[model samples]
Target chain A: MTPNILEVQNLHFHYPDGSKALQGINMLINENSKVALLGPNGAGKSTLFLHLNALLKPCAGKIRYKGADFEYHKAFLKSLKKRVGIVFQNPDHQIFSASVKQDISFGLFNLGYSATEAGARVEEVGEKLNICELFDKPTHFLSVGQKKMVALAGVVVMQPEILICDEPNAGLDPGNYKILMNSLDTLYREGCTVIISTHDVDFAYSWADTIFILDQGRILKQGTFDQVFKDRRILEQAKLKPPWVFETWEKMIDNGMVSNILPAPRSQEQLYNMMSDRRIMKRTTPKIIEYQNV
Target chain B: MSPNVIRIDHYAYMSPLRNVHPGEKIFFSLSTMLLVLAMDSILISGIVLGVMSLIIVWRAGVKCGYFLKLLAIPLGFLLLGCLAVLFSVSSEGADYDYFIKVGAVFIGVSVDSFWNAVQLFTRSLAAVVCLYMLILTTPINHIICILQRLGVPAIIINLMVLIYNNIFLFVRSADEIYIAQVSRYGYHGWVGQIRSLSLLCSNLLVKSLKASNDAFNGMISRGFDGELKFVDEVFETKAGNIAATVILNCLLITIYLSGRV
Candidate 1:
C-alpha cells in the first residue's frame, strides 16, 4: 500500500473580505499518485492548494504532511516549503529575475545548495524540461508558453515530494500542452506525487488516477474517476461535464451498444478498444444507468 | 521580435562579452570613465567615444542605427548644458571673438570659453558612452551581483532586482494598453489623448499593485524566507581578459600622457 503523502482534515478558511474560501475539506493523497482537483472558477481550488502547500493557515482545521502535523514555526515552514513546491498560474508572477537561469536557480539557492551544485542542478532541470536553449534567454522576451515552462522548471528543480500546480495547463498551445503533460508524466514516474487544479475535464479524466470534485468551497466527492464521475449528480452539482470520451461511451452503453464494464473508460483510445472488445454488444447493468439518473 | 522597452537588455544578453567576468567588465568601464572625466581633453574624449561606439556596434552585436538612436537621447540636454558654457553676456564685449549687442549687454562666444564648452561636452559624452558600454555588455543580475559583492545592503539590492524585473513587464503592459486605447481613437485629439493617458495611468497603478502583490505571494511560495537568493551566473576569469584590461588601460594612459586622442 502506498503511504499517504499528504492529508488535509476538516480545513476551513475565510478571506479577509469575509468570504468563505474553503470549508471542511478532507483529503488523502498517496505517494506517486496523479491527483486532479476539478472545479469551476471561484470554487476555491487555488485556496485549497495554498493550504496544502502551507502557504495559508486554515481558519479552523489543520493539515498533516506524511502523518506529521504542520508546525507553523519558522524552521518547520521553511523545510516544509522546500519539499512542497507550488507553481503559480502566472509565470510573470513567479519569475522575478530578468535572466532565465537566475530565476530557475532561485529555489535551489534558497535550499542552501552550493554555487557549482546549484548551477549543475539548474542546467539539469533545464535539460529535463527541454528548456536548455532558453537558459540564457531574458525572461521578459519569452513567449507565455516559454515563461510557463521556466516557472515550472524553477519549482520542479527543488525536487518537491508533492508538486502542486494551479492551472498548469492554462494558456499553453497544443504543442506545449503535450510537452507539459509529458514532463509531468516523467516527473510522476520518477516518484514525485504531482497534483494539479485544472478546468480541463478531458485532461483530468485521462491523466489523473484520483479526482477531487470541488464545488462552492466544498468537496462534492473524491474518488477514482469511475466512482466519482459515474455519479452524474456530483458532477452536475460541481458544475462540470463528463469527459467527452466517457460521455460517448456512456451513451453507447445506454443504447445496448456495449457490455457491462466494471471500470469506465477514461481516454479516447481506451474507449475505442473497449468498443472493439467483440463482447460489448450486450446491455449495461441498470445499476449504473439507474444510479446515473438519480 | 522583442519589445522596444528592453532593447538594451536584449543586446546585453546577446553580447559576446556576456559570459566574461562581470568584475573585469565593471573595472574596465569604470576606469575608462574616470580617466575621461579627469583628463578633460577633447581629443581623448573623442577617442573614447569612437572606440566605445565601435565596440558596441561591432563586438556587442547591437545594430549601429539603434546605438546611434540611444546616443541621440541626451543630445538635446547636452547641447542645452553646453549652451550655458558657450555663450557669455557682458556689458563691455572686450574679450569676445564675436558679439551680438542686445540693449546694454553684449552676448558673445570667447575663444577660451569655446574650448572649455567643447571639452565639457566631449567629456560628458565620453563618460556616457563608457557607461553605455557597461550596460550593453552586462545583464542587470550581474550588476546586482557586483553590488552585492561590494557590500550593498540587501534591501536595496532586492529592490533593484524587483524593480528591474517589473520594468519590462510594465512597459509591455503600457504599450499594450496604448495600442488598445488607440484602436478606439483614444488619442485622436489633444484632449482625448490627455483623457486616455489619465485613464491608462490609473489603470496601470491598480494593475501594478496587483502584480506586485501576486509577485510577493509567488516568492513566498518558493521559500523566500524574507530574503532573495540566487545562484550567481558562473564566470571564470581568464588570463586573456586580465591582459586585455591591462593593455587597454595602459594604451589610454599612454594617449593621455602623449596628449593625443
Candidate 2:
C-alpha cells in the first residue's frame, strides 16, 4: 500500500455559529493522489480543505500528516500549512498586496525566504503563470482572471507538497478554465498531491484518479471514477449527474438500444467508439417489428 | 478622480521617501514640531517650510499645486487661531507694533506676529509633508515591520494591525452599503441622504465589530500568537537610500537651527 500522506480519522467540526461543517469524516489521501473532492454547493468541501491546512480546528478526532499528529500542535500545524497550500475560491480575498509581484512574494516571504531568493521565485512563477507583465500593476486593477492566476502563483511559489484548489474554474472563462486545468495537470505530474473541490463533474471524471462525493458534511462515496459513476442513486442524492458521456451511455442502456454486456466508456472519445461499434452491430442485425416502430 | 478623496490612495511610485525608516521619520517630524513649539518665529518657520517644500517637489516628485492643496486644511485652522490671537491681546506693554485700530478694536495685526504665524505654518507644513511622503511610499505591511523592528509594544503593534484590518473591512462594508442604499434611492434627496448616512454609519459599525471577531477567530486558528511575525524578506537599505535620508535630515535640522541665530 502507498504511504498515506494525509489521514483524517473521525474528524468533526462546527462553526462558532453552530453550523456543522464537517461530520465524523474519515479520509485517507495516499501520496501523490490526484483526488477530487466532488460535491455541489454547501458540501463542506472547502471546510475539509481548511482542516487539511489546520486553518480550521476540528472539534473532535484528529489529522495526521506523514505519521505526525497535527490535531492541536501549533508547530506541526504550521508545518502542515506549508505542506498543504490552499488556493481559496475567490482570488480577491488573498491577493491583498499592491502589486502582482509583491502578492506572489507574500507567501514565500512569510515562509522565510530571503528577499533575493523570494524575488527569483516570484519572477520564475510569475513567468510560468503569465503574470510577468502584471508585476508592477496594482492587484485591484487586474481582471478577475489575472488576479486568480496571480493568487495561484503566490501559492505555487511557496512550493507546497499538496495543492488544494477550491472552485478554481467557477468564475473563469473557457480559456481561463483550460489554463487552470493545464496548470493543475502540470502540478500533478510533478508529484504534488492535488485535491480540487469543484462542481464540474466532467472535469473530475476526466482528471481525478479518485473521487469522493461529499454532502451534508459527510463522505457519501469514495472510489475510482468507474466505481463512483456506476452508482447512479448516490449521484441523484448528491444533486450531481454523471459526466455527459456517462449520461448518453445510460440513455442508450435504458432505451433497450444497447446490450448490457458492453462496458461503460470513461471518456467522450471512448464513448464515441462504443457508439460506432453499436451502430455496426445494429446494421448487421436484422430489424424486427418492434425495432421498426421507431 | 477628484483631488480630495482620490488623493487618499497613493498613485505613483513615490520612491524618494520609501527607504526611510518609519521610526526615524516619526522622530524627525516630532522633533521639528518641538522646535516650532519652542520658538514660534516667522523667519524660522518660513525657512523650514521653504526648504521642505523644495525637497518634497525635487526629490519626492510631489506636484507643487497638489502639495499646496494638501496644506490648505491646516492653513484654515491656523488662520482661525491667528485671528483669535490678534483680537484677544489687551496688554498696554505689548512689545509688538500694532498696524491699525478700529475705535477700541485692532483692525490690522502686528507684522512680527504675522511673520511668526507664517513661520509656525511653514514648520508644521514641512513636518506634515514628510509624514505624507513616508506613508505614501511604504506599504502598510512594511510600516508594521518597521514598527516591530523598532520594538514597539506588542499591544500597540497589535492595535495597529487591527486598525489596518478594520480600514479594509470598513471600506468593504461601505461599498456594500452604498450599493444597497443606491438601489432604494436612499442617497437621492436631502432627507433621504441624512437618513441613509446615519443608517449606514450604524450598520457599518455593527458589521465592523462582527468582522473583527471573525477575523480574530481566524487568526487564532492560524496560530497567530500575540505578536505578528514579519516576513523574512530583506528590505535593502542601499547606499543611495541612506545618503538621501541623512541629507534630508541634515538639511531640515540646519534650517531649524540657523533660524535661532
The DockQ figures for the candidates are: 0.01, 0.01
- Could you give candidate 1's per-residue lDDT for residues B46-153 as a string of tens digits? 988998888888888778878888888877899999999999999998979999999999999999999999999999999999999999999998888888888889
For model 2, the superposed segments whose C-alpha errors exceed 4 Å read A71-74, A254-263, A277-294, B1-261
Report the Cα lDDT for residue A218, model 1.
92
What lDDT score is found at residue B30 in candidate 2?
Answer: 53
Residue B257 displacement (Å), model 1: 78
Candidate 1 deviant stretches above 4 angstroms: A260-262, A282-294, B1-261
Tens digit per residue, CA lDDT, model 1, A97-187: 5678876776665556788999999889988999999987877679989999998898888888888888998999989988988999999
Model 1 chain A: weakest 10-residue lDDT segment is A285-294
Predicted structure with the largest lDDT when compared to the true one: 1
Q: Kindly report the docking quality category of candidate 1.
A: incorrect
Query: lDDT per prediction?
Result: 0.82, 0.71
RMSD of each: 22.9, 24.0
**Range of the 10 consecutive residues with the lowest summed lDDT in candidate 1 chain B:** B180-189
